[model samples]
Target: MTAPASSRLGIYCMLGGMFLISINDMLIKSLSGGYSLHQLVLMRSLVGVFFTLFMLKMEGGFAVLRTGRPGLHLLRALLIVFANTSLYAAIVSMPLATATALYFASPLFVTLLSIPVLGERVGPRRFAAVGIGFAGVLTMMAPQLAGKGDIGWVMILPVMAAAGYACMAVLTRKLGATSRASALAIHLQVAFVIVSLGVWAVAGDGRFAEGTDNESVRFLLRAWVWPETGDLAAIAGLGVMSAVVGYLMTQAYRLSRASTVAPFEYVLLLYSLFWGWSIFGEWPEPTVFIGAAVIIAAGVYVFMREDRVKATRRT
Candidate 1:
């Protein structure tokens, strides 16, 4: 079906949410040097949980927590937790652009996996898009595959995460009106809390290893530093912005189809590129750009094809 006039707004909202999410990832990566991924995930989840609960309460009473598909909700939450945790690991081990590029493969994975999982029809166009997307990935991986840095295996994490994320998106749509978005977000946070705590407990030793005095260490310490009055205001601004962005994102999915909205998520790649350059002075090499371009183009084609199909239906 063609999207409703109201659903059009969700496009912009989702894009904006993707932007905020990218910034969040960039910030975590910028600080990934001194602090472990476990710490970052734990803190982000803690902050997210605080706001998610409030929003859930305001939107609906605690009854929002009750849903027919509680098992599916928990399963979706676990998938997201796993996806994000793997993504964090990939970010710590790989280049920002590369990691983001690989993760962007989720849409293509969704298209491919839908055939089996959802019994969705797939035509030649989608098949081509999925194929080209993988080619783009191979383009990006060529260097790592042949070069000295053999940490190439880390790339699998984001790919796996992307697959899992796509599954979560599929499940989200299946959920229909059985649960509110706010409640779903809360469940995700709950799962994240359990996973993050587990990681911190097991691998927490020496992550914030002492006496390093590196830029990463400085960044972490700066997080704790009591900012001057101006800096304090800026910090407060970001926190509020984070919550606002988070809410808008929740609303986006609540209002639109996952396939329709998920493609615009590629916008995060542009944001990742910006932060990668600004914060780390790490511009991806030419091959990386070539690969990223192909991947993005394939994604765009898929999204466009979906639009065409929807438009034809409207006609």
Candidate 2:
């Protein structure tokens, strides 16, 4: 009885987390035109650390910060940084909707990677789904291949980002179970600090000096023109949303198994499409939608098949 109840709670958390993550994607797109991706990443990471820490304190105080699995935390953090950086780069370079559609390919990558890394069995039906998902990616990307003023190659950024995210997922499932969420969150920030600082140093060029010689650097460093008061509110809103989404997402995984939670991530692409159309006035091409549909269907089939297989094994 307790097991069933806990499982139900976990599923709820996972859905909540996905919803928050979708919202975060929307906020990032909302601010894209005004802010450089670099500045946005830095701001979000810096602000996010505060909220994560606060949640950690609430959960278990200082003890939550302790982790026996430093190496696993380090790997997860690095993977997260890579994913964030790549996704941000994609956001800056391509249409949000398109990039997100491509990013959805991450699950497919995860499916494939699991065979090699986790030794998970992939049946024929699941293999077909993986193939179809990649086909959808190709279908969506075909137009860009013609080089008709479409810099769609930038879509690959999100795909790579997704792969990094998938790696994080893999690590989380394999090693993070024993680690407290607070400890994991803290290590994530420490990793972010390292990555962000490294990016700032290599990309910085003394823009911090703020003088005539550094005017160009400042412009690059500054995400956008002095945002209006409303924009400021929006940026801060994104910060708050990040915290909320991250917390909910963390909670969701705590309640559920990774395989169970993984499939719902597909729903995020739908949200991305809705936001992209509403906010950016950009409707994806017909093929993009078709491709997305194929990918999503494939993912669903894979999930169902895997569950069936697991059930059979148990029986």
Candidate 1 vs. true structure, TM-score: 0.80
Give the residue spans of candidate 2 off by over 4 A: 1-16, 64-69, 205-229, 253-262
**For residues 190-243, what per-residue lDDT tens digits would candidate 2 score against the true structure?**
677667667566655434534533222333354233456776666666667767
Residue range 1-315, candidate 1, lDDT tens digits:
777965787888988888877777776675565455555555666666778779888978688898878889988999888787678667655667778988888878877767776767778988988899999988877777676455556657778888899888778767745777788778887787788677656545554445554433333232322234643333344445556786877677668765667677778878888888787776666777888889888987887786677677789
After TM-score superposition, the amount by which residue 43's alpha carbon in candidate 1 deviates from its true location, in angstroms, is: 2.1
Whole-model lDDT, model 2: 0.71
